[model samples]
Target: MGVRGLTTFVKNPSYTHDGSTTLLRPHQLSNTPVVIDGKGLLQWLYFENDVDCKHGGDYREYETICTEFIEALHQRGVKPFILFDGASNPDDSKVDTLLGRCRERIQDSAKIIDGDPESPKLRPPFTTAVFLKVLESKEVGYVFCDFEADSEIVALANIMGCPVIGNDSDFFVFDLTGGYIPLSSLRWKEARQLSIPCEKYSLDHFCQAYSMRREMVPLLAILLGNDYVSRETFDDLYHRVIKRSGNIPNGPNVRIPRTIRFLQSRQNFADGAKRLLKDEARRQGKEECIEKSLQAYHIAPESRYQAYLQQDPSMVDIPDCPLPAAYVDLYRRGAFPADYINLKFRNNRKKLLPNLVEDYIRPSCHLISQRIREAIYGILLHGLHDRAVQETGREGQDIKVFIVTGMPSLPEFGSLPNLERMIDLEEERRKVLVMEVLEVDHGRVQAIRDDLKLPVATTIYWRSKLDLPVTESGHHLMRVILLGIAICYSREDLNMDDVKGNLKEAPRVMNRTAVQAFAEWQSCMYYTMHLNTLVNRPYPTPDATKLYHGTLLHRIYATTRLQRDVNPDWVETDVLRGSPAALALFRHLDGVAQNQ
Candidate 1:
């Protein structure tokens, strides 16, 4: 959602910089406070960790990466205030943008399957949940804005008199009192010392370099292209208003400099707005569009999260609805997932994660996790007027919105636990409810650790729903889950001499059958984890960091499938050599599934 090519423009010395321009200053980033864009950091950290996105995500490895990052920041004496974006417009204003991104991810996945060495990465579901868990464990300060976090982030940074750490080009338009530190220029990872060298950009430098007024920055952003205004919308306007514009190149990269030069020539935003509005035939409502786009860069004097961050809830802006007070508190603490809010307000849930499995030939990975999602949606939209959730998965042929009506009809699920009561239910009752939701035998999961129950139950459900055979493909999925259990849950019960950290090996091409089976397993875990969160301590949330490594699991799957005469010795070395107990546990779990 950054301004297209704005990052490149800002970095170019010729466009908005001189040899002595202090737009980007070399600064030390220790012993200071900064407000970080949580969403931007999430995506950056995911790709940086090299987590396998083509398969499911490797949460265990991702957790390690995030933990180390936070720890590094803390060791450098940097107090970070992280801000996250919550539900978008209830009216679905961003659906087209969301769908467009989904289509790109779909094509990227296809390229990877066709042997592209390095394709753009897709994020797996639950990546956010894992990151939040890491933050909570580290005791970092963070909050979720009601909608977009940009304005709130700017407000808080100005209030705290600290720089903002993020890569969004929109930050260039927002006038921060301290400055903005683009993540690309920050050397936070090289935390070998107390002070990390980084580059800080200030609005003052931008204005001085361009010889333009501060008020005209937003106008320039809108004209260049932003999430609100398409660059194409203003192309004709640029042609009509500018004289001798033929010198400017005709490409996306030229938009930034061209817009800046136009704004620089005018006295003010009002002066530029007057000429741009003169062309009535080019586009109707041009005046209104410019005004609306300007609002995207508005920075309020006080952020909505300001009081909440100061531990004062009275001034927080909670929505005027009958949403449970407990849920509102969770939202304030950034403990709640944004999807629940979208379902409550929009009655529409769209999942755009492109699992490599093709949607045109078979049902979406979402369909396999429908039951779990339905239960969560039931808890979220309980007494609201909308009793059904419209779920959108892939783009073509697949139904646009699969309406999931009512709660799951499992035994004792008739009166789904409301938000208030969900968190206070008895441990035994919570276990029973979660077991019912998964359609697993109570006796089987009743003995498992509270944190392990949901994942174990999910594996059982996955196996039963898919009716996977005893072939290597099916067993490979089981082996990965068991290894995860031993690592995260039974640390003392198994040896670890044979297991190495995930190797930095290129992903091997896996057969479609194996790929699809694991995708379904990942979907099951993702939805089940969310459902468990909604229902409160039903099963203690599992340690996601120990649960899966996408590359390691994929490597195991491919090795077994490729070899003609693989043996248990290979399995022991690659999957189970260090954990005889893990293999035994899986056997018992499988035995229970067989008897059931």
Candidate 2:
């Protein structure tokens, strides 16, 4: 149940001399005196396997332990009430095999029976039929309980007025009370005599203290200790350490300071001490004193203290700075204190205090308005810009813009009054035409065309589909692009070459493999030149044919395949055929007369 490869316990037996009869007892049985000796008493036993063990091969160790425990119980005149949630295999017959093995160890006079009758449906390799057969033929009583399901089994036990035993704290989660004891804990020398007072502790009391429905026990552990961290932050730090240590074997351990020290000394006292100092400083408010104490302890460097002061000058007046450079240095050196390390790295007090308050006070309305503005901008750049550039053959600043305001009933257009005011300021600095599309007069879209005053023959009310009221000003820009203009497209329509050239200027965006692949794929699809020709022509010579045929196309194809694999939904087979503009240019070139 704990970490694998750690120390575990095995069961054994005991014998005692009574005045009238020789007495036998299981190692964990209570020392209470009984008038009868050699009388068969039913005993329930459970085994906790190492989680790290693989199936089949790992059962040997568990079998050995079970055998020892069962033999010890037999010598003490105790009958076995064997309950196993057989291994997670599909076969239901294995339970019988396990029962048969147990029968071999005990005296023929002593009976054995299965404790769990609801086990079959859960898909354990054993079924209830075999268990029932064994119990009836052997004349042993069975306690049928469904520990995995609802709390009714606990009630069933109370109704029967019999004792129950299992190790998990989860037993309380099922509203179980009275007659329940943890067998494993009872066997421990430290735990033999300490009995929980069930009368004072009701099922509700246990539920309130440790309920499975609430946060998990592990999460509760971190929160109680004030050291919880988020999973994302820990993963990020793990990768950073892995990168710093290179790709060498044991690199993760080598990069992590505490892990390295633990491996070296077979203990982690140095790291534990540093965390203690930090926790102490946080509580005491004496930053300078903590720094000096850490220095005296020889756990960190002096430069760290100076660095902390330099980073935040205002902290000089504050009693303590939790993030003192010395403490960070100690953390870097693998000497972090246990308490600080125990703190959850991502959601700890230090990380959540600043963000939590702001989030609690933030208004949802403001967030919605910002999101709408961003969506509009994306539609303009990605949906409309590309088609306009490709169809008109007009480059750069020749693109026209218009805005209209005056729609009243439409939901999206209703916001035009506010949107128009914002656009008014933007239009003053840019070459844009603005107009109002009235509802009653000439069609709102036609009015926009009149306002544009350009010789445009078409008129499109993009706001119509948007389900927004078509205010004259609100309709102008989108109307002109979608209807007035013969060709309309968004920034997504732009050639891949143009996008690639833009991205090359931003190195940070292309640092990751996914981003780099996107940029390259865009260049291949939109760039106006044949990439293969560009590379092959440069090295033209006797081996040019070999390079062009073998090296160049192969690499490009591989990259194309990788792009398709990475973004399966977006970059399909047809999209990778190369730049449409460049292909058209070649077609035009091929039509010219050769003799001329």
TM-score for every candidate vs. truth? 0.88, 0.19
Q: Global CA lDDT of candidate 2, please?
A: 0.24
**Candidate 2 per-residue C-alpha lDDT over 1-596 given as tens digits, one digit per residue, 9 for 90 to 100:** 11111011111101111121211112334322111100011112211433111110112232334455444433444443322221111222123333332233221111111212221111011112223333444533232211111132243334334333554333322333343444543342232232221111133432232222221222211111211121222233235432343233452223222222222232234344335434544554533433432222121112212222223333222112233443333332222221122121211111000000001111211121122222222222222222111111101112112221112223323322222233333432111212122111122223222312211111121122222122223232222122101111112343545423322222211112221122122111111111111111111111111101111112223333323222212222232224454333222222211101
lDDT at residue 493 of model 2 (Cα atoms): 44
Candidate 1 residue pairs that clash:
60-545, 572-577
Give residue 80's error in model 2 in angstroms.
6.3
Measured by lDDT, the strongest candidate is 1
lDDT of each: 0.69, 0.24
- Cα RMSD to the true fold for all candidates: 3.7, 30.5
Stretches of candidate 2 off by over 4 Å are: 1-52, 58-61, 70-140, 143-152, 174-177, 188-596
Model 2 residue 358 lDDT score: 8
